[model samples]
Target: MPSTIRRRVPNALLDGSRPTAPSHIDGSATRRMAIVLVTLLGLTHSNPAVAQIEGFTEPHATIDLAATENGVVASILVKEGETVSKGQLLATLDTDVLETTLEVARAQMHSTGKIDAAQADWRSWQSKLDKLRELRTKGHASQTELERAEADCAIAKARLEMAREDQAISALDYKRIEAQLERRRIRSPIDGIVLKVFKDAGEAILPTSPNVLTLVELDPLRARFSVPTPQAASLRPGSSVLVRFPETGRQAIGAVEFVSPVTDAKSGTVPVAVVLPNEHGKYRSGVRCVLEVPPPAGAGGSTSENSANRATAPQKTDGPPGPNRKDNHV
Candidate 1:
């Protein structure tokens, strides 16, 4: 039978160069066994699933629809989980005041009669001057009186021109006021679902306070998460991604939309993102889940992982190359 020496305690010297050799095992022989044991432990942790790589699942981003101006929130036009379109009305500020101001501006424009009658008076004065000059030069009127009439006609023409210009300026001012008033009716900037309505009707929503609503893209929803540095480097935008939420029973397939260029030292990770199509408005933000991102091609020198349906770890994702990358799976 082969001799078995299982657990031998270290002797006087740590390198196993004992002051005296053990009666059964030599000092050199004891050290070699210890080295072999340590090697086995090291190999276990080096496996891909055991350590050295991982990715996390999280929301891509949360967009707050803030109040741009202060006013009583007239109404929340969208309910929770309601799908909305870009530029669709999402909330309304009590624009009663803004509307009133706009009306005043309109009224002011209407009251300015300067432009309405200005050209008519100028033509009338020109006709009178023509008749007067013809008669005066024919010796029908005094030279001093003709000069006075000419000067009067010129002044009238100048006053009419000045009045018309002022009226044009007022009209422009009223149009600007109307545009400002339109701002009070809040609108959505993206085609997304209304995640929340922060205010109810008759609530005083302020510009500095939290916004009146929260929205996130729906058709092309984003799923965000983080990954360790080593794993992140292998990921590139536009790689295929698979997502699942067992609790919600939501499984979405998309592509890697974004990967942060740098890692965050504090978190010891880099952000990754994916964009999933949610035309039915069934998925939502803030849900815990798993995002399976496919590894990039040619990364790790094009290993056999591409053909393997079951990977040792999460699949790597290719990030989108486009500049408007709204779909990263971070």
Candidate 2:
């Protein structure tokens, strides 16, 4: 059975603890002391823990974008390890030949414009012939003169149609040549630190085999790691991933933007690519990392949790941590 007790004490002493004064210290002293202790206890219990994951300091990646339409490398604007921003012009190919081709095409297009005007003139002549024929039928013009006018109009009309076709062909050629010239300027595919320069100035670059001068798109990049097949089943593309960059003292979240259809037979691991934003530009393409590609968590845990408790269980982080590997995925 439960029991309760109550007693009274002096009004002034009531607010103090330790059985204060004259045996008349009021019971209010005990009450105030109890309230103070409870406030302290609540404050202590309200603090939340900050969670951190162990991961590699630097993200690793490789330099490997192939050449664009090429010619002799005219100039190399950057060296290996130089930083480049997205669309920064890193190298110039000797696009002189392409430039000449484009100029020639433009000239041809201009010539076609003249031919186009001549064709329009021929159509005008044809209209005059039709008017003459109508006038002859009304006896307002001679047959001989009307016949000659018709013949001249037919010839002009034929020449005009031929000129128009030529003009159209020339316009198309000009655009195609212009596109080739534009492709000669090689720009960085992504804002990345230049890790390698495969081409030097004056190197003979070929359209069939391009000479890539600068390789980039590294910073704040893709981290490629593999997950066990069973663990991978729930990971869909574009799913959010928790990312940690230890080197930069950065921690953030990203999305699972890629996963391999092919699985490794020996390791049973499937490749996954995650796109994590690197605003600070601190990550590299090939650095290995330990990625906590998040949940649906505990994906490979015991099957017993699969049925009931797994759906609602809170994360139990006490499990042993895994190795930190550099992610070199480009």
Best by lDDT: 1
| Residue 36 lDDT, candidate 1, scale 0-100 | 27
- For TM-score, the strongest prediction is 1
Tens-digit lDDT track for model 2 on 1-330? Answer: 111111222121233323222332235543332332222222212211111122332333445655565467788888787877777888787777778888888888878566767778887888889899899989999999898998888888778778878878988999988777667777777766777677778888776657575354544466666666655665678654445444543434455667899888876777777766554454555544545432234433332332222111111111111121111111
Return the lDDT, model 2, position 269.
72
Query: Each model's TM-score, in the order given?
Result: 0.63, 0.56
Candidate 1 local accuracy as lDDT?
A: 0.57
Task: Write one digit per residue (lDDT tens) for candidate 1, span 78-193.
Answer: 79988788889888777776677778777777775775577677777778778878988898977877777778778778988888777677789889877776777788887776
Q: Provide the clash count, candidate 1.
A: 27
Candidate 2 versus truth, CA RMSD in Å, comes to 17.1
**Ten residues in sequence with the least summed lDDT for candidate 2:** 312-321
Question: Least lDDT summed over 10 consecutive residues: which range in candidate 1?
Answer: 1-10
Q: C-alpha displacement of 84 in model 2, angstroms?
A: 3.2
